[model samples]
Target: MFILKRQDVEISSIQHPKRKQNIPILTYQGQSFRLISVFSDHQQEEAKAFWRELTDHRGKACVLLEETDRFSIWGKVSLEQLRAEESSNSAVSTYTKACILVLQAVYIDVEDLLGGRQAGLFQKDITNLFEKLKFPQADSPKAVKHWLNVDPLSNSSVPAWEEHHLITLLQELYRLGKEYFGNTNFAQGVRDILQDMPANDQNQFIDWLNQSALGQLWQ
Candidate 1:
């Protein structure tokens, strides 16, 4: 039996035409895995909580999306989402992208520190350690879900050196702010950019920053 932990699973509803209401089901590659009850009044809140739990056990947990057959690492998903959202021109979106890049750099650095990659395998044992901080917009949850279901091990090459590059980019952003807006504190500049973000996004960004290398420097 393929037992899945409740903490590792997220329940999404699908239409049940005959029943005239939505039914909560867990499916993987068109196979019915489990049926779970819908108890939470707010579906988005429940999903966010589930994601946080998954993030806490990222390396140990295997994320299996109902729409995909393969399990994926948390880091791959975070990277995919970061790439997807990086094009947005909004202030919050830009700041969030930078933060994700920083986290990814740290992740890669840690992987390098543990052991140089062995030939024929791409850090298979390294956990992708990051959270899906933003809630998916209602218009494209399925697409977002699919994008995050990436198999990190499928890649043949290690990520290019990024820690110093990303740090330089962050410093450049801070410099631009100081030159153009007279904001001396980089953290304050980040706060200003995030001013218009929704409360949930702001809170998630704060949490992510607190765990980042930049956050350590700021402190």
Candidate 2:
């Protein structure tokens, strides 16, 4: 939760470690592994330099993962041996992040996309999606509405949704287009949407799309 500790430094944030250290903790899965999050308030170029240097890593516990706006976020892991292999958690989460990015890019005004009648159905679909998934916030009406409340011109924070949650949403969005609007050109529509996105986001979304089930339509 605490992404940053102090100026360019981050503290560990996992449950109990074999050896007790001076930091807070939370249980992950059934196994508790200590983790840290490093943050940098640097521009893209400087952040890249910092990332290159930090990744030399050695015994350090932070790896650069993003370069956005005026900050870069790094996942700081407390590992005795810095492994070269990527974590599955990070890889899976990237899909959710990219999907969130696409949603943010489109920033739909439900009224514009679905109109009054179909908009209600779209809302019902979202409610049902969360309820069926049994997400912690499934019962929260605001949580269901959160997905629809996007700002077209703003870069919003992404919800901490898992891969399944995002994939299902993408499927639902596709379904809504097909069923309600008769917009069968799903992949081309995505391509057109990306034409307006930032270069980095477009590339990231493309990578996710290429691997996603929905992207198969046009590819």
Candidate 3:
């Protein structure tokens, strides 16, 4: 059976749904989307597994979103060219996911470094990172979660990616770390996550970071 893919989310609380509620809206790349689908929970799981197989064998575009539960939502995304070409979109999305993984890793690293202080500065830099990455209005973690249809710290899904995108993200992250918490604290955070990162590409990613415009910091 065919079913749509959706990412799971957890929320503290949500306003009760209106008897006639508007569709949940996700704004991405300057476009507004609210994908709707209906299938049994079992079928949903099967659908996700199918997507994983497709991603491993042949990349595809992000074209669906579904409501999983209260305060828990599902979403997906992909850059379908101005005219939607499968081959090119597939290649681009593959790399896009790698870049997103980099984004997720850095977010976790920096958040751990801050240790829950400086909400304003943290939000500011995160917002800047989203803007710098040119992802539209993902000016906060929540926004990022919504746009990517997954959380940064979560491992369920990834968007299109590229090596340069990873470099830009890390380089900017390094700058922000230094500017906000000093070289010592920022580098300390990098050291903390070196054992694993960017998924299995940790060593290569670290090497790329060390060679990036910012140069190696933790090492």
Candidate 4:
């Protein structure tokens, strides 16, 4: 089960009294979504209230929650439900670029092996990994899994992006959050902190452990 409040970005998993962490919630930008593991069903009152809140905002906003699992992402619900109004050349170009950039990010991680002795051995895997997707050329699942194994900072395969282009894309994402949910800012501070990260030394590991938000995401 899940609930969404567009006014904020939030996502949460529902909890039972017996659960270790009793907070039955995942909230993203003040919007809350929940996954119910113990309760096999929704209470009538809870359902009614949730339905009412959503219906009241009908055309104004949207939310999506899987009935079996509590998972949610803002604006995705409405966007998926509603067909895009019009198709434009610029929109097509934007989609293609996003697809290409994401794929490039994946490819850079392995491109170093392209001319090496390992190339023949991994060729099939690489081909399959880059196979086309509904979202055009997206990173293959295999590549993404490999990305998960990599330490973002340690990996020497970071993708190249024009400084202006990278900043523009990031800024666009930031503005989307601000315009819709009023987050105002996202990732900027994190990026700044990352830029200031000290070189690996005796204290590097501990300092990184303390400063990193990526590590906290799993928890």
Ranking by lDDT: 2, 3, 1, 4
Could you report the Cα RMSD, in angstroms, for every candidate shown?
16.8, 15.4, 16.8, 17.9
- lDDT for each residue of candidate 2 in 120-142, tens digit (9 for 90 to 100): 66677757656754543344567
Residue 42, candidate 2: alpha-carbon lDDT: 41
Considering TM-score, where higher is better, how would the candidates rank from best to worst? Answer: 2, 3, 4, 1
User: TM-score of every model?
Assistant: 0.23, 0.48, 0.40, 0.25
Q: Each candidate's lDDT (Cα)?
A: 0.35, 0.46, 0.43, 0.33
Which candidate should be chosen as best, given lDDT against the real structure? 2
For candidate 2, what is the TM-score?
0.48
After TM-score superposition, the amount by which residue 50's alpha carbon in candidate 3 deviates from its true location, in angstroms, is 42
The positional error of residue 78 in candidate 4, measured at the CA in angstroms, is 8.4
Best by TM-score: 2
Q: What is the lDDT of residue 1 in candidate 4?
A: 24
Per residue, candidate 1 scores C-alpha lDDT tens digits across 1-219 of 233444545556654333233434454433443231111222334333333443453332323232232222122222233344334324344343444433333333334543444310212211111112112221243432322332222322222212222333343333333443344443444444445545666666566556544454432
* The 10-residue segment with the lowest total lDDT in model 4: 210-219
lDDT of 4: 0.33
What tens-digit string does per-residue lDDT give for candidate 4 at 1-219?
A: 235343444444433333233233445555443321111133334333334433453332434333443222223232222233223323333322332333233333234534434333333343342342111122565554453344444444433222122222332333233333344333223323334234332133233323322222211
Pairwise lDDT winner, candidates 2 and 3:
2
| Model 1, runs deviating above 4 Å | 1-168, 175-183, 186-189, 216-219
